[model samples]
Target: MRGVGIEVNEEKVGRTMEVDEKSVSGTRFCLLLSPDRMRGSLCLRLERFRPRLGSLPGRRQRVCAQRRSPRARRETSPARWRLKRMSPSPAVVVLALLLAQHPSADTLRVPLDYTSIQEAIVAADDGDTVLVWPGTYNERVDFLGKAVAVVGREGAQVTVIDGGGSGPVVTFGSAEPPGARLEGFTVMNGNYNVQLRGGGILCSAGATPVLIHNIVSDNVANYSGGGIACLGSSPFIIANTIVRNRARPFGAIGDGLGGGIACDGGAPTIVANVIEENIAGGTGLSGGGGIACYGGSHPRIDNNAIRHNVAWSTYGLAWGGGVFCTDASHPNITGNSLLENHVQSQTVEEGGAIYCFDSSSPLIRENAIRGHTSGSGGAVHTSNGSEPTLVLNNIEGNDPYGLVNDEPGVTLCAVNNWWGAVSGPYHPETNPGGDGDPVSDGVAFAPWLASAERLVFVRGWPEACRVRQGGDLRVELAVFNRMPGFQRFWFVTSVDLPGGASFGPLAGPTPLMLLPDGMMSGILGHAIPPDAPTGLWTYHASIGIPPHDTLDHAQFDFEVTAAVQRLLRSRSLDCLFPSP
Candidate 1:
C-alpha cells in the first residue's frame, strides 16, 4: 500500500492532494490530477508497477508516469519520466512544477480585454502593442509618455478615430521617443483652439513619434494647423492623406493659417503626403491653405502632391495658396507638385503656388507648379525681403504671371526655370509697359532658357496616341533653331516610356547643323513588350546647343492598348515590333 500527496501554490490560493495506493489491485494506481490555480490543468497517467521477483519482501517497483497539460496538449514535450513506485520503506511522491510562459512584449487586444483604446493604453506597460479591431473609436487617445504602439488590426479605411468635433484625436506630448508609433487609422473631426493646436495629432516639446499610413482629414483649428500642428517637435509625418481640413475664422484678426499642416519652430520631415482641398479662412493675413511654416520652422517638404487648397481673407492680404513660409522659415521645398491652389481676397493676394514673406529663404527646386491663381504672383510670390532660389522647376500654365515680387525694392532671383514660353514673357519684363530685356526691378527673369528643353513635342499625334501592347511606337520630332545666327547643335530624342517599353537604335542625340532659320527633324522608335501595362506614356526630347546648354525640349503623351492582335489584323505595321 502507498500514499501520494500533492500541493499547489498560486499567489494567495493553495490546494493539497493525498492519494492512497493500498486499496488498488494488480499494483496499478489511478490518480486524477487537477491544478486549477495554474494557467492550464494537468493530467497524470502512471503505468502499472512491476516488482523484482526474487528480491527482498519490500523490494521497490518502477512506474512510468506521463504528464499532459490541458492547454499544452498540442505542444507537449516527449519527456515522460520513469520513477520508483511507493514501497513499504517510505512513501515516494513526485512534484511537477508548471512555470507560466510570459512574453517579452505583450499584445493587449481592444474590446476583447479592454473596452476602449485609452483603457488598453492605461493598462498596458511600455513596449506593449495595443491593437484595436476594425471600428470607429470616438474617444481621444493620448500616449501618456509610454513607448508603446497603438495600431489598428486592419488598415486605415476600416479603423477610424473620430474626435466628434472636440479635442485632438491623438497627442504625443509627453516627450515620447520615436519608438512610440501611431499607425493605420483615419483620424478626423478634431477641433482645437490656439492654445491647443494639432487637431489630428500633436507632437510637441521635442517628442518625436512615428506617424505613418494615416488619413488625417476634416479637422479644424481656430488659429493654425487644422489637420496636424507641430511646435518645437520633429516628427516623421509620412504617407498621410490630409484633406478638407479648415482653419476657421476667429475674431477680427485674420490669423487662421495652415489648413493642412502647420509647423512652428519645428523640423518635421513631411514626405509623400496628399494635402488637398484645405481652407485657411480669416480676415487679415490669412495664408497657407495647404501647409504653413512660421517662427523659423525649417521643415523638409518633399515628394508631396499639394492641390486645390484655398486661402480666403475678406479684409487683409492673403498669401500662399499651396504653401506659406514666413518669419525667417527656411524650408527645403523639393520634388513636389503644387496645382490648382487659390487665394481669394478682396484685398491683395500673392503666391498662388508658394508664398515667402518676412525674410524666409526657401529653396524651391524640381517642383511642378501649375494652374495656381492669385491676385499677384500666379505661380510664386515673394515679398518683405524674402529671397527664394527657384531652380530646375517647371512653373507653367499659372493664371496671370509666372513669378511676382509684391514689394517694390525686393528682387526675386528666378534662375533656370521653364515658364511656359521660349521667349522673354516674365514679370517686370512684362510688367504692363516694360522692355523685352533684363531689368533690375521686382523680378529678375534673365538667362531663362529659350524653350522648355524638358518638354518633348511629338507632332500630329492624337490626345492619347494609342499603341498596341506588343507593337511598335514611331515618334517623329521636328527640331527648330530658335537661337539667333547660324549655329551647330545636337538634338537628342528620348522616350519616358511606360513599363515594358524598350528603346530601339533609331533614338539618338544625332548631330546636325542648322542655318539662321533652319528646321531639322528625326524619328524615334520603341518596342513595347507584350506584357506592357495599358496606360498613358510620355516621350521626351531635348535639343542640346553649344557649351553645356539644352535650349529646347518637348513632351508627348501616348497610350498602350491591350488589343495587339486586333491592331495587327487591321494594319501592317512597319516600325519596331515585339519578339515573335
Candidate 2:
C-alpha cells in the first residue's frame, strides 16, 4: 500500500484518492472510489461502493472520469443511501498518519557477529532479535534495559546458558520493558550469595520481561530463590521447567525461601511450568519447596505440575512442601497438581501441600493435591489469622491429615472437595466412622464429593508397545465407586490381529455404578499367543453406558513387522519399566 496523502480535487472528484492504513484501524467502512467503472452520486451511496479500511488500497481505489446518467441515478431510492458528507481535512490527516511500524527492526546473530549474549544485547537496539545458535554459553547475561528479544535457534534441549556457578543465569533488572524476552534455552549452574539469590533468573525493580519455554535446573542458593527470584517486579513466566534447585539457609534469618521460584513483593504470572524435585530451607528456618511469596506479593500460580518437592529443616520448623505464603500475601493458586511433596523438620512442620500464615489468604481452587506427607495437615495448614478459601479440589491420598487450621477463631471455607472415600473425612469428633482422609476440627470438610456412579480406570499394557509373537499384552482395569449408585456401564473391547485375524467384539455387564461426575481413564493391550498371527495388531477399548453411548474410548497398536525381521532389533526400550 502506497503512503499517500488525500488528493481529492473537486475537478477530479472521480479520480484516485489515498488513505492511511494505520489511521483507519477500526471496524468502520469508507466510501472508496474503486478502479471498477462506477458512475454518478449513486455509486457513492451504494453499499457495494463502500470498502473496509485496509481492504482497498490506494491503487485499487480509482474512480472513472465518466459520469452516470440521470435515469440510472433515479433507479436508486433515497432510503438505500446513508452516505455522510465530511470535510477533506479529517481524511487527509488520517491518510498522512500512515507509516510502517517497526520498519527499522533487525535480527542479530550470536557468535556469528558477537561472541557473547551480553555483547549482543549491548549492541542491539529496541525491537531487535538476537538469535543465538545452539551451544552452551558459560556466562551470565543481562538485558541492560533493552526492549529486545534473545531467542535460541533451537529449543531449550540443545541451547544452553550455563552460569558457571557464578551469578544469575539471566538478569532483567535496570527497568527493562515488557518486550524484552528471553526464550528457548536451558539456564543452569548458576550460584549467587553462596549459590542462590535468583540462581537461574532475577528480575527486580519494576522490570517486567517475558520468560518462556526454558529449562531452569540444578542451580543453588544459600539464601533464597534457587530457580527464579522477583523483587518488586512482575514478569510473565510461561511453560518453563524449573527443577532440582535448592534454596539453603545461610543468613541469620536462616530461612530458605522458594526453592523453585520466589516473589518478594512482586506479582508474576507463573503458568504451565513443571516445577519438581526442588528443596528449600535445609537445616534452617525454611519453607516453600516449590514456590514462596511474601511481603504482600500476590502472584498467579496456575496449571503447573509441582511434585516431589521438599521443605526440609534440620534445626527449626519447616512449612509448605509445595507452596508457602506469608506476610499478608494473597496469591491465586488454581488448577495445579501438587503431588507427593514432603516436609521434614526438626521440631515441627505443617502443610505438606500448602501453608499460609500471617494474614496470607490465598485462593486455592480446582487443584489436585495428593500424596503429600507432613507432620500435621498433609494437604494444607492455615494459621495466624490466615483465612484461605479452598473449593472444588481433589483432596485425596494425603498421608496424615487434610486442611488443618490452627488459628483459634478462623474457620476455613472448604466445601465441595473430593476425599478418597464416600464416608467423608475421618474426623474424630465430627465423623467418627468416616473412612476417607482425616481433617482437623476447625476445618469445614462436610458435603465432600464421591463418585455418585461408576468410576472407570482402564490402562493399556504400554503406551508405545513393540512386542514379538508369543508375548503377553494386556490392559489394567478398575472400577471404584464408594457411593451407593446403581451399575450402568460396562467394558467393551475389540482387537484386530495380524494375518487377517481379529478377536471377538466383547461386551459385558460390569459391576460399576454411574458416578455423578463420571471419570474414564487409560489406554489398552492384548495377548500374543505362541501361534498368534505375526502382523499388525490393533485394538480398541472403551467404557460404554449401554445403548451405544460411549463414556470413553482408546486405540492401541503393537509395533508390527514380519515375524522373521522382528528378531533383528533388540527391542530395547527408552525409559521403560521393563520389570519390577
Best candidate (score: lDDT): 2
Q: Clashes in each model (backbone N, CA, C under 3 Å)? A: 9, 13
lDDT of 2 by residue, 100-218 (tens): 11334666788899999999999998767788888999999999988887888675778899999888889988878666878778999988866447989989989878787689999
Top candidate (TM-score): 2
Runs with alpha carbons beyond 4 Å of true place in candidate 1: 1-103, 193-195, 407-410, 427-440, 450-580
> Can you give the TM-score per candidate against the true fold?
0.59, 0.62
- Model 2 misplacement above 4 A: 1-103, 194-196, 251-253, 452-580
lDDT of each: 0.63, 0.66
